[model samples]
Target: MNFSQIAQLLVLGMAPLGAGSYALCRAKARPERFGGAKFHSPSWYYGWYGFLWAFLPPLLLAVASWILRLAGLRPAPDWVLMALAMGLGLAGLVYAHRSVNPELRARNSVEGVIHWTLRMSSVLSILITVGIVSSVLFEALQFFSQVSLWEFLTGTSWSPGTAFLGAAGRETEGVAKPLFGSVPLFAGTFLITAISLLVAVPIGLFAAIFLSEYASLPMRRIFKPALEILAGIPSVVYGFFAAITVSPWVVNTAQALGVRADYTNALSPGLVMGVMIIPFVSSLSDDVLNAVPMSMREGSYALGATTSETIRRVLLPAALPGIVAAVLLAFSRAVGETMIVVMAAGLRPNLTWNPLEGVTTVTVRIVDALVGDQAFDSLETLSAFGLGLVLLVFTLILNVISAYIIRRFRQKYE
Candidate 1:
């Protein structure tokens, strides 16, 4: 294989080997550690320790090397660098393992590294969000400086054609509004999201209920995974399905009903997006629902409540906060969805409510504005950042509210 392929394989191999070595070390450190024996540390802790030693150094080296390359510095050959890094990393692991006491210093040190790793993962997510927000803010600030914020927001016209074509010094015939009037985009997003939730929520909830409350062990094993298969299909495939098959059918059906429908309207994409989000809503909701104490269920049943009634009144209420969190998370997913909307929803930004007619969403516009080659500072290009900022804010607010509610719910239960 080529260098890239070889690098990939080496990295992949390192992860499992590191994991296995850590597991071995943990097993060795634990005393009779079986049922009735004292152990040096928990088995899982040792596994994580091994994972740290095996994965962290090489990963860091690779990342640092890539950054250096980006900064225009040529590094040593990949094979030589990889070999030296791995050798040094392994030597460090060995030294730490032997020098640190398994019961005292090593355990805490390993645990500290693992904890730091976990915290780093969370920080990585937050940093990514901040980076996205910063990019949007910077670009939107540029766009706003060029075009008045009032005209951008309130003017009833939107044709980004001038921004793309660089039609400079033309006489002003009328106010040239941005093609980014969020009303139609937001409306389209909500309509599509509503449709998706409508499609996904009931089916997912029922599926979860069946899995958690009614299914036999064998059936649970079979169906839970089968349902999850929906989540695994690449979104591009869903987009294609919606574009080629579903859009035509929707147009035809709308025509039969005496409604004017674009071949690529909101309904097909919304419906497909709903299908895509089903597993997310259902899986999370089911897990939250299942987390409700069995004692609560039994107490309700003892009071003469039937299974369904108990589920509705007791279990559902108990799990309501988590369920809401799940739904909100799904809503965020729907809002941020790009491919399905891009492929299935018409690009025309019509400020109409007729779901049968064509409509566009913020994500659709962002894609349209940013995809082709154009002046980077143009309103059309920068409008993407503005749209992204709005979307980011909306989703961030939802996430915050969901997190607060869930945290409060947990405190109440505790």
Candidate 2:
């Protein structure tokens, strides 16, 4: 038998063994309950207690086998392993069923196990996050060992595909030395993000204000969901919309005004991304603005202030923390956006301020590198992890800045 067969047989054995143990424990516990004896816990707890004991030993053995394999231990014969697993499981079942008495605090024991299991699960999540970070850091460190950090940061050239090309995949003849400069990539990312923000912020904020304050209840109900529907649309759909429809329109509009524009310009994706981000700012800002104390609005009205004046002087200031948070969230979404930029924005990686020109982003390059035919250990492949590390740092810095802003805003406003 192979691994899958052994696993299947072990599972099949454990299932019936657990069920039989549960049945036996319940039958034994019931007679004591009907015989006028006080039970410390419910009858089901005894059943679960028996089931766990029967299954847990076998699971531990499997885990131990896996650990041993990882440590280069030879595998035992499949029949021997299967027999050992089944024999231990059956032994556990018999021992646990016999131990289930009225005085056994089976419920407490089960609950304690459940509590530990939940705690372990939470810890596992943290460990998984750590593992991901560690893997990226490790690979990025390897890349930096080959390519300088200063060159990656300051140099403008980013011709990794051509530079890192070779059969042996080393710094051999005909393979140009790699340029890891990330300035163009970061510039394009931020430039698109800046355009997206300019378009999204004012519109989303104003929409939020109108919905939460000015619009009638029925109108608010109708308009709010309609606005949020944009958020529900997939990024691919937005990408296609930008590429096919928006790009040509932008090009034509620029030409009509006697200005030059590329077909795969930055503005198109930026606009579509802005549209994508509208609901993030609008929905959250609306909720935050509404959460501002009603008394504040009443006070502004009592002061003979108009709606606009009240919002400027009272409501907005009070809701600044949440509003800032919403904008930060939108900015992050725009920064991380890939599909829209890949489809709409050109992959030229130009470090320019002009929105009509093409540009590429970190995520675009990361996808390109991973999907290429490069060897797994090659410089081209490892560059993805290096880019990932940079992306991770950028996102972490954004989050930290957002946290500081929120904390300062809360302290001042509260």
Candidate 3:
């Protein structure tokens, strides 16, 4: 059946499920005089039990049919499949209603179903992650077959212009060979990330301190939400603000100081990205600071410490681990950011320390390589996956470190 027809059938199917639930619930909730023993579970458990029975049959059928289709075999006609699904659903509903009685452990049955569902979800997520890693690794191997891993990792140049011709089996010996040295890309990525952290960390940490330790409740409520609202703004919008507003301002300011700066300087995107990452640091840091035991603060105060002294001596140390984790998480976020860098930071793979010079990140280059008309098997195209693998590894390391730090912090605090 078509989408609307299938939707209507599914919606109609829910009617019976809802009716069965309400009927079974009301029946189970009757006075004890009507039954021998107390009801094993609440009335809602029966309702949910019936609902699951009504829903699961059709969903499983649909999934089975989809899998069959993917295997290049048609199991049945759409109408026949729909009929079978509905038939099984109705049968399940009838069976559920018949099974629901005073002696039946409805809660145990429902909880078992829920537990398995959660377990299956976890397994599915792991499978998806494995699949992604496998695909990227396989493609990266293809790219590395043509480009040396050592050169890709250690070389500084990143020109892949002639790689497409090489992929198409053309001679490219005399012409300039494609270089896939990822050092410049990684360097740019780190430079921008570092600049962003410089802008975000201090401001975010100070904001968190004010909100958690110093601000009044009324001011905290207003300012915290306002600060978080910055995170809600889209990256593209931030990129636009950086490009249109921040970039030119940086250029003009640099010129005023007798320093030459590119319009697409690294500093502008870094500053803008830092603003974007402030919420990640501030929100988590504030929570960590607040979670510090009140007794620590009181004890510090009793020791004749001023508020600043108490914060520095007691609260800061207490929350340091969590704050570090927040900063690391924010750094990971800054590393992976694409649009802000794409728009504000020019796509020049410049290996330099100057923030005023234009630089491109791994993400931007990945986007550039994929968006072109180059063949998929081209070294340039496959290079995206190689870059992706590096990015993924870096991100995973940061996450692992963050998790370890948080675990250590919790063990100490809790």
Candidate 4:
């Protein structure tokens, strides 16, 4: 059979083997005299052992088959090899289970292997993260090689089109700076984030306070998960709402204030993003606020401090570090957001301070540049990497600083 077919058979083979292994392991652990030693684990542990034996060997063999293909040693379809490997592994496990004594220490040895397998699974996730970071770094390095570090960093103009033309062509007209500067993008990110925070923080914090400090247990049970429902709403829905409904309302509201406003401006998206993040901020803030020593709040209240005073002065200060961390986390989420900005914010990269005007963000540009099929070597494509790297560095710095602040605050409290 073809490779894919074999692969499918292998996957199908694994299911029965895994179930059979578990059954065999449980049977082996039954109180029956067989081979010499006594089983050290419970029936379930043996079952887990059987599953590990059935799954791990075939997985390893499939990996080996892939490597062989990469090395031009394709002998049989990968699926066939995988199925064969799994069948063999299952046979070995069954033989071992039937022959081994229920009271034997073999179960312990199998359990050990199962534990190692579980730990190894985590490497898949870590390796994927490392792969992404490595790719971004490599592409960013390539971009820097073509564009001088100073021009890319310090130059107010960010027109990457000049980088597309070779030195021969650039000698006549010089590099035409991209009309879209990153500052506006950065500013737009901050403006939207700031507005979102303004909208979310107070509402989220108050909700958190009500839930944690004032709400009845029944009310908390009902409200907490309801608040989390906000987070569960798909971001794309938020984008559509901002783009279709919120933008027009914002424009009309600005007109009422005797100011012109673009329909697709930063305000609408920022407001929607704020609504999205409120649950995040509230949930985290609530946890932090609740973590404050009850005695502290009681002491303030006993001293005749009102609820608001105690919340503002005692609970808030106590929770400041965690709240700051939460805010920074929310800010990072906002900054990295793409859909809301892409759908609601206009694509025109104007270096304007006015949130009422049409402006673009770094994330929007990154999407625009990389969305369609294009040659990877082109400047337009490479510019996405450059912008991504800058964004990565910015977020990393903020995270580091926020972590430092949180740690220092913890130390003070301790």
Candidate 5:
């Protein structure tokens, strides 16, 4: 149904709820009614109970109708469904109003509804994740059927420009076969991620240490929020900054030093992406360091240890798991980043060790494959899913390692 129709249905459902709440409130105040028994719940709970009774039926109806439509079935007209929903809501409201008695435990009923709502929300989230993985896996399987997994993983070249012609059965006999080697993409991705971590980890860790251990209260308050503002800035904005500002500076500085650098060098985007993710590391590491016990610091002082020594030996070790987790999380963020890499790092899948050279990441290649007018079943188009699946696996492995580190070594300080 349209927004207006949905709003009208919700209004019809909720009007009785407000009425029921106030009515029960007034009724409960009159103790002589129902032989002076105390209410099983507060009036607000009764109101919510009535609200759910009125709302759920119509919501279910709409969902069922929508599902049926998706399955290619003819459903009732919107107005007819809206009318049916209104009738169900009114009937529910009447039932709720009549059922309101001192013996009815509306609080329990309302809480049960809330519990189920939360459970359903969790289920929906899990289902969505499973659906996404399954769909990508299926498509990636199709891609691998055409291109061998060995070549895709170990090949050094990634020229897929003419793969479409092969898929369309029009490949010229003299043409070289399209190579799907993903090694360069993976290398570029890791190269950028390593550069970003190099810039982010030291700066972010030091900032966190200063905030958690050294900075004054006022300084910490001002700086922490200011630092976190970096996280709030959009990736596209960082991409723009990298492209317009950092890339040119890198090229010019390289030329001044008699070293050549591409305008789309990996360093520019890496630096920008590092700056963008500094808050992720800093914020998380700060919280973790702060969580280290005051008792540990006191013990260190009692042992005649200096502040720096205490932090290095005691707090850092204690919070190492959290710090590692934060670093890994940042690694995942850096690996998955697209906009900055796309804008600053050129789309050439170069297998090179030099950060000054332009290179493409998996995410950039995925975007390239899916963006233009290409056949849906083409090897080039399906390669996006293959890249996505590999990326997904990489992320999952990182998460598993992070979990293991946290679970195995995390210290519980009182």
Candidate 6:
């Protein structure tokens, strides 16, 4: 049987053990025990105390067995593991039931268990993040071993058409040089991201400024949710809109203006992606703007400052940090978007500044590599990890810059 089935059986066994132990403990906490002596904790705590003791040991043993098996050590069969967990759980339940009495600190024990459970859950979240980073780094290391970091980062060409699964199969291709250069992919990704930000930041920020400073209570109530509705709409719908509606419009508009444009231009997806990210910037900026102390605005008004000037000088400076953060977040969202780019942007990685032309992004190529009958050990497949690592680093750098800007703004605002 698989690990999940074993876990299900063990959980099923522990449930009965806990119920019986809790019933026994509650019985012991009755008024007849110790001649109606008052208990330190409630009867419920004593019951839960039994429940925790009954479950923890079995859970630990099962986890240990799974870890051992993962480490290439033969632990036991599924039945044996289940039997061991069940036996220990029953033993622990009986002991826990017997140990509970009027003098026992059952409430403290239960509260401590609750606290530790929360602490472990938080730790587990951190560990999961670390594990993901480590796995990506490891795979990227393997990919870089085959392709040099210099070529991957600096070289321009990025076609990894058909890669063999192993070095032994290299002879079939006769020492064929594989180009893993990522400059075009990076260029395309940044081109779309920049266009997305250009469309998102000013429009969203101005919308926030209007909502916070100009709009009345009823207007705020109506417009805020209406604007946020943009965020809730599915990306696939946006992708279809970009492909069908926005792409053609762009092509025709450019043609009417006597310029050439492609059907799958970068501008279409970037514009749609920007519309999707607008609510993020607007919502966060609105919150930050509203949080800027009302007294500051009132003081500026007392000094005969107009609303526009006060907003420009006082509110914007105070709220610059959060606004920067929101813009950076929108930029990241645009860079990481997949469906819209796949639907509206071309697959060809074009390294040009013109948004009128078609371009592909890192996410598009990553999806391209893994969607087909790609070999697990192939160069194309492994390049996805390398792309992911580069994206991770780029995101980290953006976060660092945001943090620095936030800190500097806070120093001045405070």
Q: Per-residue lDDT tens digits of candidate 6, residues 239-306?
A: 99999999999999999999999998999999999899999899999999999988899999999999
Least accurate 10 contiguous residues by lDDT in model 5:
22-31
Candidate 1: list runs displaced more than 4 Å: 1-65, 73-104, 165-180, 404-414
Separately for all candidates shown, the number of backbone clashes (residues 3 or more apart, or on different chains) is 2, 0, 0, 10, 0, 0
List the candidate 2 regions with Cα displacement exceeding 4 Å: 1-103, 166-176, 214-226, 286-319, 411-414
lDDT tens readout by residue for model 2, 3-82: 56547865788888889888887777775445767778888888888888888787677767766766878578657777
Q: Write the per-residue lDDT of candidate 3 for residues 164-216, one digit (tens) a residue.
A: 99779999879898899999999999999999999999999999999999999
lDDT of 4 by residue, 332-365 (tens): 7787778888788878766667778777778887
lDDT of 5: 0.87
Query: Per-candidate TM vs. native?
Result: 0.78, 0.79, 0.94, 0.86, 0.93, 0.83
TM-score, candidate 2, is 0.79
Q: Output the lDDT of residue 78, model 6.
A: 78
**What lDDT does the true structure give each of the candidates?**
0.76, 0.87, 0.88, 0.77, 0.87, 0.88
Flag regions of model 5 displaced more than 4 Å.
2-8, 11-32, 169-171
**Of the candidates numbered 1 and 6, which has the greater lDDT value?**
6
Better of 5 and 6 by TM-score: 5
Error of 6 at 346 (Å): 1.4
RMSD versus native structure for model 3: 2.1
Candidate 1 residue lDDT tens string, 94-168: 754553234544567676876897999999999998887787898888887777767656644557776754434
lDDT by residue for model 5 over 98-180, one digit each (tens)? 77788888889889988998999999999999999999999999999999999988999999888788667784588877789
User: Worst lDDT window (10 residues) for model 2?
Assistant: 162-171
Candidate 1, residue 59: Cα displacement in angstroms equals 6.3
C-alpha root-mean-square deviation, candidate 2: 4.3
Count clashing residue pairs in model 4.
10
Clashing residue pairs found in predicted model 3: none
Position 220, candidate 3: lDDT: 98
